[model samples]
Target: MRLYLTKAALLAAASLAAQPAFAQESDDLIVVTGAPAPIAIENLPAAAVVIDVDDARVRGDISLDQALADVPGLQVPRSGPIGQQTSIFSGGFESNHTLVLFDGVRIDDPSTPESVFDAGQDTLGDARSIEIVQGPLSALYGSGALGGVVNILPRRGGEGALNPRLEIAGGSFDTLTANAGADGTLDRFRYALNAEGYTSEGYDIVPERIATHDGEKDGADITTLTGVFDYALTDSLAVDLLLRQREARVDYDPGIFGNIAENPGSEIQSDTALWRLGASWALSDALSLRLSGGALETDRVSSDFGVAGDEYHGDRDFADFSATWSITPEWTLLLGAQNEDENIEAVSFGSPVTGEQEHWGAYIATQGVLGPLDVTAAIRQDDFDGFGEEFTWRAGAAYPIGEAARLYASYGTSYRAPSLFERFVPFYGNAALDPERAETWEIGGDARFALFGQTEGLELGALYRASEIEDLIGFAGFAYGNVDRAEIAYAEARIALRPTDWLTARASYANTDAVNAATGVALARRPEESWSATLAAERGAFSGQISWRQIGSRLDTTYDDFGFWAGTAEVESYDILRASAAWAVNDEVKLYIAADNVLDETYEPVNGFAGAPASLLVGIRVTP
Candidate 1:
């Protein structure tokens, strides 16, 4: 693996030195969902990344978090298989500080008492595209958007007659997956449907009884189905409808700290159903109106047998409405409101703490463009029954430099209410915990240039961001409370190039310095520095890529057997290398091979956890 990475890096250098002559192309494409108006990447002032559907498809069946694992500015603390928590730092907020969406709909989990869950769900297989804007987003998305927003774009039907796809894969660790989807248009309407199933025996980072509790039995199984409908009512009117359902059964082994004590088994089952209805009307060429309404329902149950027996059951309903108007060619306004009702019941089969609580919030945004620049501003006031009203806001701007390049910048504020686990879960819940609040700021830019006037493009981007948090929340001594404030600064850069029709290359580097500003302590699950690079070449029906990723040392805090505390514990870092290739036998079939942890690096993303060993997979795809 190391040899392959060295070869790829050398090849990239050679390509740069060769400076092969090729054609040059130029164009300016504006980006929305981040800045107020569409602005070219080169002139966009903030640090952002866009992964289109084509790129996503080429990445195969990897979870969205795994596919983006090496992105310089992002941090994904992988739990196992499809479960991970993805968080971006503007200053130093956790995943709860980030806001995530699917096709403009908030996808936060309703099972955890708070509408937030681990970032794992955001990686559903139906995603067609993903956009990441790193900075404060309070003004645009309201509270809980202090770090950034990640939007997953769904695949909608185009003018084509029909599009269909199928994929199946199996590998070691008892992992298996199957996916199928289709999109088509019929006269005045278009429709899309997708379904997927995934299961894995899972590889334990910590052996079942050796660690803390029992780490050997950690694994997951999940299934999902989605449908989309769109219709053109008239030349000036259109409507869209979306429905989705998900079910999951999960089990994990919690490691023991010292000697074997108890073998507590956890079984969790969850289900979610959601629907969206929307309409768009064109009042004029320069003005349009869009109205959308959505509802979500979720149910979850978890049972832990033996040791610390516990059971949890919960249900939630959410409704939201929003309107967007294009007042002019370059000016847009958005107004929206949301309400959620949650009913939860939890019992510590042995502890004697059983309780339930109910939670709800309403939000607004405006954006415009001026000449070569775009600007956006937004605000929201959330009224929690017990916590009172809290407000958040954000402001951002982007500018285009020339035809192929841009810059972007933004600042925002955010806040998070305590979750049921933190506020009311028996001994673990600290009703006295304070709400988490934060302020984040960021600025960045990117540039595109021809390599020796070659048609193959070379692009470079960089960003600097900082954040400060107050009244942060965490678990300590089996209770939740307001922790010390935190501050973080991060900087990163990336360079990507396509040296030839058959060759592509990329390199990235990042530095993050996060501290508990009040206590001067380092943050958890964060690396001080990280780097990655990849190179690939394709010819005719054959293509292959080799890549390498590295993470720096990290720190974790844990309580000792004495029930005291351990602080700033150190963990070693490690590197991983991977390679993959494919052969298109014909239009109807293809054969592919992939390998990970080629070096079998003995390291964990988290302390005392199991990391992937060297493994390989071979698969085939068939299309009619």
Candidate 2:
């Protein structure tokens, strides 16, 4: 069984690195997607990661790509199992070159064709954290941030009492889940709310193909809701509001290439909505002002059995304005303006299409601290009515190397624009595409000391990234062009440990080399090595976690025997393990248990699907 799960994950990492370390203390997190406010995380200079909500409640992660699958130059993938369709590749670009946000709006999907953003329809109840910044950010989010940016930070409420929560869960194909929430703060107003639901009965994501007899299976159902509101109106003003929604129905199976007909009643249904409004003003204490606006909508339907297949509608409206000047205390400045509009309607075979696009942007940025370094720079310009102009820039630096290390470097430029179903879909639209530029560079560092001699605390990090992608939109001889060009390089490493005071550990690694510099191939499902490890523990109220992940072999794209497009194949390598536990049957109750693919190792991340197996879950939670 893979050598007994690699000797039980090296004996649980050598018994958590041979225990015996104490004095644990932690908390040094603050991030805002690496800029535009909130900082710290070692002064953030890109290459970031956060994942809060207590790390998705100690790893019983549900969606958001299983809580970003051990982030580190991320690559999610997944085309089968739970809610199916998920993608998020970074550094190697593609998957719409990253960029996804929630609290601050923008959630791709402009009638697809690369307007990506679908982490299995995201869910982490009311989130509260999830940063992930990595590399190119289109000079502060614009176009699809070349290869990084994921925000999702919801849950907010202030002042005092009133807090409530509830949860329930069930497992193994025939899964179920439920959640509820509440938040507080009265004086000057503040609030938060959440709701969630899930259902599953999935399996047979191509169950070893058998020439298709569609034994039907492949299920999902989901629902979610979130809300937040804030108001101050004094002490320098404040106002904010947000709302979110999601709905889904999924099931699938049909093509695993060539012939293999057995539709088994395909399905897909979706709905999404988001809204935001905001205001903040300080105008002193180094000056400040902020404004925001947002909207997002998505609708979809696809069916096969009960007829009617294909229909989509998408929309987005956005606005933003910003200002900040801390012209002292080591200087800072930022300025911004943005607007976006997108619309789409699509229907299949019986034909029907509609499209719209609009964008405008302006930006400027600066940050400072000189002796011992910390610097940042930015620039942006965008205007795209018909894909006309674009400009992006970024610069970064960070240095510390003293009180427990820091060092960083960055360079960036990005762009993506080209999705209105790749420019008006009708016989495969193409209004003369353009806009797919990129350039990136990154360097990393991280350190934090005190290990073993007690006072536990350890952290280490490393990163290196490279990129090049020029006008690379694909799909030839039948529209959607800009032909191809791409190149990518990657390296990442991470470690975090706490040694005592009840365990904690983490590890990560990545090594990728994407290609396709115009047909040299190798970029399909990307994976040139990947890794992950995790362990968590808590005493006095019981808690637990264990995790492992791996992916290596890659390359996919096959289909011959009349289905055309025949070529690459190789999608081997795989490993996964998971476990979870919780108990706090006291302070308002809690109980949990979870297990997933604990060695039911059958792999296929794409290429004929089928991946997820061995599952179990049980849960309960309540708070007051």
* Best of the candidates, lDDT: 2
Candidate 2 lands at a TM-score of 0.33
* Candidate 2 residue-wise lDDT, 115-150, digit = tens: 887888676888766656667878777688888777
Clashes of each: 30, 1
Candidate 1 yields a Cα-based lDDT of 0.62
Residue pairs clashing in model 2 are: 158-185
Residue-by-residue lDDT tens digits, candidate 1, 1-624: 110111111111111101110111124343332122333334334555456543443434356666556556677766444543333433345757666666666566644544454555443457666656556655445446667666666666655667787877777777777778888899889988889888877665342323353435556788888888889999988888888888877665432443223333765666777787777676765544555666666665555663334545555455555555667766766665666555555554354433344433545566566666767666777766556677887776777777656677777787776665566666577776667888777787777788845653797878788888898876565667686788889888888897776787989898988888977878886778888999987899998888898888877553343323455586777898988888889997777777888888766565444566777666666654
What TM-score would each prediction reach against the true structure?
0.84, 0.33
CA error at residue 593 for candidate 2, angstroms:
8.0
Best by TM-score: 1
